[model samples]
Target: MTTTTSGPPAAVRSVSPRATVRLLGAWHTTGPAYAALADALRSAVLAGSLPVLTRLPSERELARALGVSRATTSAAYARLRDLGFATSRVGSGTVAALPRDASRHEVAAPPPAGDAPASDTPSADPTTPAADDTIDMSQATPSASRALHGAYTRALEALPAYLDGGGYAHLGVEPLRAAVAARYTARGVPTDPDQILVTTGAQQAIALLATTLVARTEHVVVESPTYVHALEAMRRTGARVVGVPVGDVEAIESVVRRTGARFVYLVPDFHNPTGRSLSADERRALADLVARHDVTVVGDETLTDVDLVGAGVPAPVVGDGTDPRLVAVGSASKSFWGGLRVGWVRADPQLVRRLAHTRQVLDVATPVLEQLAVTDLLEHRAAILPDRLAALRAQRDDLVDLLHERLPAWDVPRPDGGLCLWVGVGRPVGRALAAAAVTEGLRVSPGPLFTPDGSGQDRVRLTYTRPAGQYEPVVDRLRRAWERVGGR
Candidate 1:
C-alpha cells in the first residue's frame, strides 16, 4: 500500500471477505442460503453496523469467505438491489444502502441529520426490546429555525426578479454568495463572494473537492472518529486515509510529513459527535503545520454556527490569506435544517471556477428557491441564534446527565456546542450494542462507523438532536441493549 507509481493507480474498493462473515454473525439460517444471507445483511445495514455505500465483497470472494456457493452470494446481491438496499454503478460494484433510496449518485442528505442514511436511524435496534415509540439518536439535525418561514417568505418576494432568468447560475445566485461571503467576514475571515461556491449541501461540496483533488494511494488525513460520510468522501478519492486523534497536532503533522499528504480534512468547530472545539493554540499550531508542509486543509464548519456551550471556537483554521491552500466548507444543515440542502465552499477564485465546472456535473445548480431561503436565513440569523443555542445546550446537558445515570459505565463527554456526544462505553461491544439497539427500536451509530480504518469498537456516538423527552427512553433502551450484549 505504501509504494507509489508514476501515474494514478487503478482505483478499486475492496473489503476483506472475513469482515463480511463477521458482520453476518449468527445470521438467520433457517431459509435458503441466499434469502437468509440477504436478511442477515439487511439487518446489519439497518442496525447502523454496515454503512450505506459500502462495497459488498465479490460473489466468489464472499462465497469463499462464508463457505457458501458463489450463486448464493450473487443471488443475495441481486436481492439487495431489487429491494433497493443496494445499487450497481459502472465503476462501483454492488454497494450497500437502505431500501427507500436508490440513487448512488447524489449525496444522501447528511445521513438523516446525523445518522448516516442506509446505515439509518429508522432501522431497528438489536436488543429486540421495542420501545413504545422508536427513538432515533443517530443523527441530530436541528429543527428549522422559527425564522425560516419568514425568511423564505421574504425570499419569495425577492424570487420573481431572479425568476425572469433561466434560474441557472453555476456558482449559485450572487446574492446568496454575497450573503455567505458576508458570513465569513463576520466570522473574522473576511471572505469575498468570488471565494464562495455554493452546492446543494456539504456532501456534494466534499465530493466535488475529492473528485478534483484526491488521487489513488495519496495519503489523506482524517480525525480518527469523525463524520462517517466525510470518511466515505475521502475514500472515494481512492486515497489512503490516515486517522489522527482529535486535537493531536503532532500525530497529524507526522502523517502529513511521512505520507507527503497534500490534503487534510478536519471539523474544528464543535466537531461532529464529539462536540469539542479546537483551542486557539491548537488551531494556530495546526495552521502552522499545514503552511509548513504545504498541505491543503479542508475544514468542515457546517456546525460552526451552532455554538451552544460557547467553546469560543477559534477563527477558521485555514484562514483566508495565511494558508491559501485551505478550503472552508460550511452548511445550513446544522444551524437551520438539512432539508434546506444549502452548503458552500470558500476557496480561491480560480479554484472556485474549476470547482464550478466539477460541481455542475454533481447537480447543475442548487435549487434557486433554497438558495434564496438560505440567503434569507442568514440575514435573520441573529434573531434565531440565541434560541437555537438554548435548545441545543438544554438537550446536550440532559443527554450527558442521563447517560451518567443509566449507562453509568460510559464515559460520555460534555460537548459544549456540537449536536452529539461521543460516548466511550468502557467496553469493546459497540457493534453488538448497535445490533442490539435495532431490537430496542433505537437507531444509534457504533464506533467503527466513525473510524477511518473501522477500529473504534468501544465507542458509540449519541446525538442529542432528538426531542428532550426522548432522551429518557433512549437511555432506557440503551441500557437494555447494553444488558442484552452482556454489559453486566
Candidate 2:
C-alpha cells in the first residue's frame, strides 16, 4: 500500500549561538557530555523555550560558543534528532520539533513561572491525561473569586442593552473603561475613561503595548526573571530584551543609557516568581529614570491585589499615570477569574486609541459579556477582595509552612504579595527537579523559564494558588523530586 507523508517543516527564524547556549543551562551534570547537551536541548524544546520550527545555531558555531568540540555538538544534534526534539533539512540545518508520538502530558510546556493568569497556563495536549491526574505548579493564579458568578449573572441581565448595536467594542464597553479608570484614579493615579483600553487579559494588554510602542531592532529593558511572556511579546516586535537586576533602578538606567532603550517593562507592584515588590524609593527612582531617558514604561500590576500581608499594594511605577510614556496593565484573571479574561491598559488617551486600532488586526474586541462581568466584579470588589486575600494568605502560609517542614534545605522566602514563592533550591537542579517532578505526576516551572537569558538554574517557582489541602501533596511531590534529583 502506498502512503503519503507531510513535507518537512521549514524554519521560520534562527536562534543565535549565544541564545542557544543560554537555553542549555547547567548541562554538565553526571552524564556523557554529548548526551547531557542533547538532554538540555531536548528539555528546552519540550519546555517551549526553543519553540518548534526555530532554527538552531550551526553545530560548529554552537560548539565554539559553548566551548565544546565540534564532534560533541554534532553528536548532540544527532541525539536530538533521534529523540524527535529536532529535525534537519537541506538548508534549514537543525530545527526544534516535537515527536509525532509525544504525549500531551509530556508536551505542554509549563506556564511561565510567574503571576500569569491560571487560564493562561500551558495545558496538556488534547490527548493528555485529565486535570486531576497532574499537580500543576506552574500558573500562580487563584481560583475564581466567589463573586464571579453573581457578576456574570448580572451581566447576563444587562446584556440586552447592547443587543441593538454591533458587539464590537474596540475600545471596550464604556462601563468597564470607566470602572477601570476609576480604580486607577482611586489608586492615586488619576485616570479618565478615555485612557483605559480593555483587553482580553493582562497578556493581551502587554502585547498591544509592545506592538504599539516597540519597533524592530529597538531595545526593551526588562527585569531579570521578569514576566517571561512579556519578554515573548516584546521580542515578537523584533526588539532586543536587555535584563537588569530586579528592582535595580541604577542597572535599569545604565542599560537604558548604554543601549538607548526606549522601552521598559516592570512588574513593580509584586513581581512574579520572586514575589518581590519594589520599595517606594525604587519606584520613584524608576519613574524619574524612565522620564529622564524618554523611555516608555509598561508596569504590569497583574498581581497588585494579591496582598498576603495586608500592607496594601504599592503605587504604580509611574505614580501620576498621565505621562504618555507610561502604560499600566491590570488583569481580573489573577484577582477574580481567569475564565473572565478581563484586563485593561491605562495610558495616554492617544496611545489608548492607537492600541485600540492596532488591536483590531489581532482581536476586534474582547467579548462584551466578559467585559460587563468584569465591570460588575470591579464594582463589588470591596466585597470580593477581602475573601480572596484571606484564602490566598492562608494558602500561602500553608505552602510556606509545608515547604519549611519538608524541604528545609531550600530557602523559601515569604512574599508580601503575589501568588508564588521563588525558592532557591541550593543547587542547580531546577531542570532536573522539574523533570523528576513530572515522573511523580507533578508539573513545575523551573527557574530558567522566568529569565530571558536562562540564568535562574538554581531556583523554582511554587504557587500557593492550590487549595491548602493540597499543599502537603505538592510538597511531598517536590520533596520526592528533589530527592530523586539529589538536590542539596
Candidate 3:
C-alpha cells in the first residue's frame, strides 16, 4: 500500500492503482462508495501509510485500478479536496496534503535541532538534541574534526594578506582553488585552478549549476532516491526533473534520449542514503554516455573522500573535467567540518565562468576565512582522513550489527563507505515510525524524504555518524518507535 508518487515541478510521480487498492483494504465499509473511499484515503494519510505531498492516482486511473465506478472516485476526490487532504493543481493533478486541523503536532512541536536532512553547512541556530534524552538520527554528519582548529588558526594568520585587497573573491581565492585542483590531480584527474569556482557550500554549487545550465522546461535527470536538497535545487530552476533508478546507466541514457534532458546529476562515489559507489566500468560508461549524448552530467563527489574501507576510490567521473559536459562538484564538509562552508565546481573553465557569473545574483562569494581553512585541510587531507574513516567505519559496523540484533526484520546492509545506512524495515511504516520516534525522544528522517517518487515507504536511512556507544540507544529508540508503528 505504499505510495509511488513523484515530487514537484514535473509532477510525474503517481500512486499506482495496485498500490491504491492495497491501501484501501476493505474500504467499502457500510457506507456510501464516495464516503468510504474518502474515509479510507483520509485514514491512510493520517496513519502515514500514504505520505503527504505525493500525488494520488487520477479518478479514472483509480477507478480502473480499484475496479470502481469513475463517479465514486470523482466524488471521493472532491471530498478529499474539501477536507483539505488533497489538492488538485492544473498540471500537477491531485497531491496528498494535510488539513490544518490534522493534529500532526504529535510529530511537529519541540522540533529536533537535527531534524533537518544532511547538509555540510551549519544552520543559523546551533544544532542540539530535541530534548535532553533525544537521539537525533536525522542528519548524516559527524562533529568537526580536531584538525579544523589548526586550519582556521592558520587561515587567521594568513588573513592579513587578503585584507589589503577589495576582498570580492567572486571566483574564490587563488590558493584554495589551486588546492582543490591539486586534490583532483592527485586523484588522477588533472584540473586547473581556473576551472574551479568555489561556493558557500556544495548546496550553493548545485544551486548555481541549476541556475546557469537548466533552462525553463528543459529536462534534468537525477537518481530516483537522491539527495533531497539537490532535487529541490533542480526543481527550483523550473526544469522538468525526472528520476532514474540509482546507478542505472541504461535507464539514465534511455530517459535522456526520450526526454532530451540537458543535465544528468549523480552521486557516483559513496552515494548518500544507499551508500552505493559506482564501479570503474560504470563510471566509464557514464562518462562515455554523457559524451555521446552531448548532455552535461554533474557528478556530486561531496562524499567522495569518506571512504571507510582503506580500498582506494575510483578516479573522478569527469576524467579531468576537460569535457564541458562533465562537471564535478565537491565539498569540504564531509572531510573536515560543515561549519567551514566551502565547496567548489571542477568544470570546463567556460562553465566555471558561467557559474561564477550566475552565482553573483544569489551569493557573491564564499567567506575568505572558510576558503583558506579548507585549503589548509586539503593540503593536510592525508593526515585528517584516517581517524575520520576509522570512526565512521566503527560506527557503521556497530549500527548494522545492533539493528540486526534488535530489529531482526530490518534489512541493514553493510556498505564499504558512506555515513548512512539505507535500511529496509520490511514494512511500509517509515513515515509512521518517524512520527512515533519523535514521541520516543528520537528524531529521524522517513524514507520518503530521500526520493522524488514515494516508492521507498518500507525504507529508512540511519546515519552512523554518531559515536559507536550512542548507537545502542539509537537502536533502542528505533525499536520502540518501530513497535509503535506496528512493525514486528
Candidate 4:
C-alpha cells in the first residue's frame, strides 16, 4: 500500500487495487457502494492511516481492479472531494487529505519561534517570492478599483487652488481630514478634523508612530506573525518588540505589564496573515486593558473594510476614538488601492499637532492630489464596497477550488474576511516549494517569512486580490511546480 521515495528516483505512487480494497472495507452492506466507499476513505483519513496528499487510484484503474463500474468509482471520488476529505492535483490525481474539523478554528496560532523547521533539508536554489514571469502571490494588495479612477478625475478638478499655494500640507489637505473624520463619526466613532493627521500610506503612519511613540530600547507588544512590514517598522525604531499569538489578548496584556511596554500595536479587524478578527469579548477586554494599564495602544484598521462575503463587521477596537490612550490608523489602501497611498491617524488633537511636526521631518507632507482623490473615494465607498465584495467573494471561491484541484495535500482554511488565505502545505518544505515555484514562474511567500522570530516553515500565505482569470494560470504553474517537486 505504501511506496517510499528512494534516493535517485522519487517515484509517484498510486494505490494498488488490492491495497485500495483493503484500505476501504466492504461497501455492499451499505445503501450505495460509492457513498459507502467515500465514507470509508474519510474514516481512514481521520484515523491517520492515510497521510495527507497520498495519491489515490484513478477512477478507471480502481474500477478495473475492483470489478466496479467506472461511473461508480468516479462518483465515490467526487463525493470524497465534496466532503473535503480529498482533492485532485493535475498529475497527482485524487489525494487523501484532512477535512475541516468543525471543532477547531481555522485561525490557528503561530507556533513558538523555536519550533522552526530544520534548515539542513535539501532544496533547490532560493528564488525570490516575486520576479519576472512569476505568478506573484507574495504581497496582499489588489489593483485600484474603478472608484479610484473616478476619484482621480475629481481630484484634478479640485487641484487648482492647492497648486497656487506652497503645497506643503503638514496637517494634510483640510477637506480630506474633514471627510475622513465624518466617516469615522458615521461609523460610531465621533471624531474631529484636528485629531486626524494624514500620511502617505498606513505603512508610513505606522513608521511615524514607531518614531514618535517608541523610545530607544523600550518594549513594544505586537502579534507574533502579524503584518511583516509592521514587525520591520517596530524593529526600525530600536524597540525590543515582544510578540504574542493572535486570539489571546491576555498574552499581550501580560507582556505589557511585565515589560512596561510603551506602545502596543494590534490589527483586530481582518488581521493580515490570518485574516481573523478579535472576538467581541476580546475587543471589550482590549479596551479595558488600555484603560486599566494606562498603556498607549495603536489600532491598525487597514483591512477593516475588506470584510469578505458572509463575514459580518467586527466591533472596532478603538471605536469613536473616545479613549485617550488609543490611536487608530485608517487607510484607503486595502479598501480602494495601495497606489492612492493615503492613510491617516486618529488621536488626541495635541498628539496630532506634535506628530504633524514630527511628520514634517519625515516627508514634509502627504501629496495633496492623492489626498483629494481619497476624499472623493470616501464619499462613494458605500456604493463601491458591495460590488468589490461580490467580485472578491467569487475570486476567493475560485482560488479555493483551484487550489483543492491542483494542490491536494495543502490544508486551506476558508477565511471569512480579508484578501489572503493562510495555508498549510503538508510538509516542512515551504521554502523549498516557494523556490521551486519561482523557478516554474510562480512567486509565493513561505510561512517562515511572516513570523517575527522566524518560524512556520510548513505554511504559506496566498492573496486572492488579483482578477478571477489570474487564478487559473497561477494554479497551472503551481501544478507544474508540484510535479517538479515530486519528480525530484
For every candidate in turn, the CA RMSD to the true structure comes to 12.9, 10.5, 8.5, 15.2
lDDT of 2 at 219: 77
lDDT of 4 at 420: 88
Task: Look at candidate 2 and give me any clashing residue pairs.
Answer: none
RMSD of 1: 12.9
lDDT of model 1 at residue 316? 80
Question: Where is model 2 poorest over a 10-residue stretch in terms of lDDT?
Answer: 114-123
lDDT per residue as tens, model 3, 164-264: 98888999999999999998887887888998999999999998998888999898888857888999999898987776657878667766776788798
Q: What's the distance in Å from true for residue 17, model 3?
A: 20
Please, what is the whole-model Cα lDDT of each candidate in the order they appear? 0.76, 0.79, 0.79, 0.74
Positional deviation of residue 421's Cα in model 2 after best superposition, in angstroms: 0.9
The order of the candidates by TM-score, greatest first, is 3, 2, 1, 4
Candidate with the greatest TM-score versus the true structure? 3
lDDT score for residue 284 of model 4: 82
In TM-score terms, candidate 1 sits at 0.74
Candidate 4: minimum summed lDDT over ten consecutive residues — where?
2-11
Clash totals, every prediction? 13, 0, 1, 1
Candidate 2 lDDT over residue span 178-272, tens digit each: 99988988989888899899998999999999888889989788876878799899889998776665776776776676568888898987698
Per-residue lDDT over 1-488 for candidate 4, one digit per residue giving the tens place of the 0 to 100 score: 11223312111224456667876666454578788777666655543334344567788988887788988888988888777766775555676654555212122233234322212232343532345566788878888788888889999999998988999989889999999889888778888899899998999999888898899989887775678888899999989776566656776676676567869888888787788888888888888888889888888999888877556655667754788788889899988999888999989998888888788767899999999999998899899899888888788889998998778778887788888888777654556566556766677777656655444555677898888867998887776555544412
Residue 11's lDDT within candidate 2 is 56
**TM values, all candidates:** 0.74, 0.74, 0.76, 0.72
Candidate 3 lDDT trough over 10 residues, lowest sum: 116-125
**lDDT for 290 (candidate 1):** 76
